[model samples]
Target: MQSSRFVIGVIGGAAAVVAVGALGTHLLSGTQSTTGLDAHSTVTVDGHKALSGDIVAGRAQSRYHPLPWVGDKVSDVICPTGLKAVAGATVTCTGHRSDGSTVSIPVSVVKASADSVTWKFERS
Candidate 1:
């Protein structure tokens, strides 16, 4: 009977240690924020013209909010004016997070034409 009790006690202690370890890992991971936007897509434009900063910023914000684990953490996105509607053009945009931090988002025009422009947000 004593041996059986000892074995049960050891098993219980090990289970407690595993439970505590799992809880600690979960708590530590909860404190971290995983907010990022690495997206690319095409947008339709009216004519062969430069892309507006507002359009770019709006699109970035829209794409970033629905991302899993990010979920509106980035409140806004700001881009420069006069983004050329031509392939190979690049710009750096700033993403403002809810924590009052900013992230650099690089935008590049991958494909462009008279009626549409495909842009990519490069990882930074």
Candidate 2:
């Protein structure tokens, strides 16, 4: 009977540890959106930090040098606002994974089309 009680106590302790671990992960995760981007918007490349003029669904890529990953995590490339951004214009976006980490990036913009901006994952 004593041995059975000891075994049960060990199991209970293990379960408690697991619960604490899960709670810690939830608290440490950064706050970012996993939802896809809008149909029309500007892109910011972390590599070059260049903000090109507005682009449409089908357009040439602007200048940028990509690093692929930052601090071991995929980062969202962003262009600093300046060219013609104004208040109420959501030129800035915060991207991330389901846990709120940067995993995707917007390499270009397609104002009124379905064009996808390229991130040029491979650096030349």
Candidate 3:
């Protein structure tokens, strides 16, 4: 995580108000973890259970939507197929930015069960 400082100044008649604020930033460059993800939308890849690429991409897009700088800039997310849902499984998704550039989003599976799976976004 990174930190940034912002200053807001309000000037009025004979009075001045200045506010300083600090925010911890993720900026799509930090690790974000999520748990208990629904595993219903899954498939079998080489006899192993795997999450759907489309579903993972959609979920990743939703996760990126709330980010500060890269949220609004991302137009779409594309993940590779056959992402195993087992523990320690990893994949790198691509985020297409509005400016025609691409961002790499690495993901790792933390846990997996019949009903749910937990995954985390690796720091870029």
Model 2 Cα displacement at 62 (Å)? 26
Q: Give the Å shift of residue 22 in candidate 1.
A: 25
The residue-by-residue lDDT of candidate 1 on 1-124, one tens digit each, is 9999999999999999999977765553331122222223232234436567666776666665543443445657888663567888777888887789787777777776665667766433
Tens-digit lDDT track for model 2 on 3-106?
Answer: 99999999999999999977765544423211122433544444322224333101211122112222233324443341222212223422333356543333
Winner on lDDT between 2 and 3 is 3
Considering only N, C-alpha and C atoms within 3 Å, which residue pairs clash in candidate 3? none
Winner by TM-score: 3
Give the whole-model CA lDDT for all candidates, comma-separated: 0.62, 0.34, 0.65
TM-score of 3: 0.63
Most accurate candidate by lDDT: 3
Q: State how far residue 108 of model 2 sits from its true place (Å).
A: 18
Which candidate, 1 or 3, would have the higher TM-score against the true structure? 3
What would you estimate as the lDDT of candidate 1? 0.62
Query: If ranked by lDDT, best first, what sequence of candidates would result?
Result: 3, 1, 2
Candidate 3 segments exceeding 4 Å error: 1-40, 69-72
Deviation from native of the Cα of residue 107 in model 2, angstroms: 15
